[model samples]
Target: MADLKLKDLRYLVALADTRHFGRAAERSFVSQPTLSAQLKKLEDYLGVQLIERAPKRVALTAAGEEIVERARRILEASEEIVELAKGHRDPLAGQLKLALLPTIGPYLLPNVAARLRKQLPRLELMLYEYQTDPMLEKLHSGEIDVGILALPVQMDGLDSYELYKEPFTVAVPTSHKLASRQSIKVDDLAHETLLLLEDGHCLRDQALDICSGADVNEKQNFRGSSLETLRQMVAAGVGITLLPELAGRGAYGAARGVTIRPFVKPVPTRTIGAVWRKSSARREAILALAKLIEAHAL
Candidate 1:
């Protein structure tokens, strides 16, 4: 069998990751027919089928799964070599792929990204927005160099540095009784219909944890897909919801008919942090970015 090229392995990995021909081709930056033909050649060269093809679905064969895992390791090692070389040049130079959660990105990034550009002019910053689980998955797979997310994340083989502790605030419609309060306590939430983000968001779980001390119940029939949606719901008097401090200062909390109140002493908060693979060669760059974010995140 002929030796496989790095690009071939990359295509296989993309296909394995996405499980769709069109998406894999787009990820690999190749045409669909080109990716298909190259994959066919790879299969012929290896004398085994990599994927089970159907009209509407793509499934990796057992062999494909094993090969894809090996391909990931090889690609990661190759990237590490490149990063090691770049590390000696300048700590903040070159491309850095960073993943951030949707909850934090809008409120925090706008303030920090400009500072980053001015401080590290040579740095090429690439950003991806995702939820905590997918962000961690990308970090572990070496698809992203770092992740900025809310902490207390329990994942092995990664290191994180706390940037800031962001407190949660109660958002209520102007007509709501809680809106008249100067401050709120966990007990105040009891028996209130709390609007929350849908599943897969860390903020939703964090809010639930804060409410655990009280008898707070969720708006079972309604789950906002984003914080903006929840803010809208609150402003419309649908239900009250929790907002991160930064978010409270943003446009969402400033919407008409909405009132924002801070929690009393021992306020519920989530620690935001920057996390990277423990073995990453871009540690200095990631740390540098973290420092910049920490300075402006508040």
Candidate 2:
């Protein structure tokens, strides 16, 4: 039997991940026919049917599932080897893929990116925005190098460095009764209609936790997909929503008809942090980035 190539293994993993020929081909950066032919060659070389292919679906055989698990480790190790070689050259001069949650990215990344560019002039930063779950999945799978998200994620196999804590503020229409308050407590929001981001966003869960003991009820009929949308809803007098400190200072807060007010003492806050795999080879760079983020978080 011929020695299997790393590219073939990558293709197999991509197929397993996407479960669609065209999608896998796109991810592997190859044409559909080419991916199909290579997969066929791989199957013939191994003398086993790895996938059950139908017109609309793809399923991996039991052996294929096991092979994919091993393949992922091999791919991760290969990346570590490349990163190790690069690490010896420069600490922060190569491509760094950073994942950020939508809740934090728009409010924080501009300043952080500017600082990183000035400090590490040769660093090429690639930013990808995803919610917490998918971002962590990508980090563990070696698809992304680092992730910026709320801390206390409760995930294993990852190490996080605390950057800063951001407090949440209440956003309401200027005409709303609470908008005139100097500062309100969590209990003040008990009877208010709270607008929240959709389920996938960590901000939603954080907001819910803040209002846990209160009598606040989420507006079940509608959910904002992003912070801007939530701000718009507040401006339009739909319902009040919680905004992170940085977000409240952004354009949304500056928008007319929307007033942002802080919570009284012991405010609800989320700790922002940088996270990466514990065994990653780019630890030094990630830590450096984290320091820069911490400095600029204010």
Candidate 3:
């Protein structure tokens, strides 16, 4: 450890993450030869051949792979140490990279983006929109600072705060007889054709659970890729579907021939939350974004 250099470990981590010398060099902001030479120095010092190199690609040796894993942990801890020191100075007014599940991104971002810019003038915000799995992956790898996702991510090494629960409302064609109902219940949709989003959407799963609990079958004749598509399908009398509160508002505003109804019993709802790696360095900033969203959402 007497001769260990932070630059050497950083090079190892970049190589491990990118799996290509040139790309790793790019990430580390060093020339390819400089990165390669430093890695060679590191290997020589450790008395181990860390990587098998060829003109085409690079592969890690057994010890190299093991070292890479350790390198990742070391680099993460080092970065966290720096971040923690910075956090001690100021919890806000730093770079914040955030990701959100697709279902919530479009519906929620517009409402709060301007306010965030105004409130935290010195805070730089970077946002990404992704589905559940990829969003969680980015969170784990420290590729992003925080994520807004549906509840029950249930992943290890992450802390989650439940922001709010939004109920599911039924979407029906305005001309359909059931659209006139004072309130639609799951049982009421038993005989109705139900449209749904394609698989992988958490909203679709929540909708299915609500329908199943009431002994209603979701008709799969038509599936939409997005809430807007589902609204179009409902207006076309393709089938009925359930939408979250934000989506319901859009249908009410722009979409024609679609009526939203609250269910009488067994109302469907999903909890939205802010998720960050348990080891994250910006707890205060993450919570700040969560509070902002909660305030605007309500």
Candidate 4:
């Protein structure tokens, strides 16, 4: 058998994750044929059949599964070694991949991205927007260095720092009865139908939790895919929805037809935080970013 290559191992791991040649190729940033050929070459070198080919689907052989498991550990360790060296040199000097919840990214990032750029000019910030669960998946898989999301999430093998407690506000159409109010109580939402993001959004769940004491009904016929969509729906006189304080700030939506009002005393809020893998070597970078976010409180 010949010596193993790390890139080939990466290709193999990508295949294992996607279970499709075309998708694996895309994940590996290679052409389908190239990835397939290298995978075949790897199998030949190892003297075993790793992948079972089929017209409709791809399946990994038992040997492929075993090797894929090992490959993942090796890849993680390899990345750790690189991260360790970079941390030693300058923890925040390299590319920092971050994923944020869609509900927060649009509203929050605009407020802090410029600051991050000015403070860590040497660090290249790569940002992505994903809903809560998928973002956590990327963080755990090491595809992203850190994640910004709602706090109290069920995180295993991850460390988190609370950045801010952002209060939730009510967004109602200007013509609605409640629109004239300066502030409303949770009971005001009783028996009201709310436009909300589709499932898989942590915001949706958080909204429901806030109204748990009240009898708030989620609109069944429609679910907004994003906060902007929900805001538009509310503006169209569809129904009221909750918006994080940042989303209601002047820069984000500030919709013409939508009236945003705060809650009365004991305001409902969500704790936003930065999360990273516990084993991550970029502690200094993560902490620095967290500090910046914490400083720019909502």
Tens digits of per-residue lDDT for model 2, 233-282:
89999889999999988554598999999999998899999999999878
Instruction: Give each model's whole-structure lDDT.
Output: 0.91, 0.91, 0.84, 0.91
Q: What shift in Å separates residue 184 of candidate 1 from its native position after superposition?
A: 0.6
For residue 52, give model 3's deviation from the true position in Å.
Answer: 51
> In model 3, which regions exceed 4 Å deviation?
1-89, 250-253
Per-model TM-score versus the true fold: 0.70, 0.70, 0.68, 0.70
Residue range 82-152, candidate 1, lDDT tens digits: 98977768877889999888998888877787888899888898989999998988999999999989998
Q: What's the lDDT for residue 255 in model 1?
A: 88
Q: Report the candidate with higher TM-score, 2 versus 3.
A: 2
8-86, model 3: which lDDT tens digit per residue?
A: 9899878987889999999999999999999999998999999989788788899999998888788889999998888
Better of 1 and 3 by lDDT: 1
- Per-residue CA lDDT of candidate 4, range 1-298, in tens? 5689999999999998898999999998999999999999999999999999999888999999999999999999999999897776987788889888898888887788889889987887899998888988999999999999999887799999999999999999999999999999999998888888888998888999999999988899897988888888898999999999999995766678999999998999999999999999887899999999899856
RMSD of each: 17.3, 17.0, 14.5, 16.8
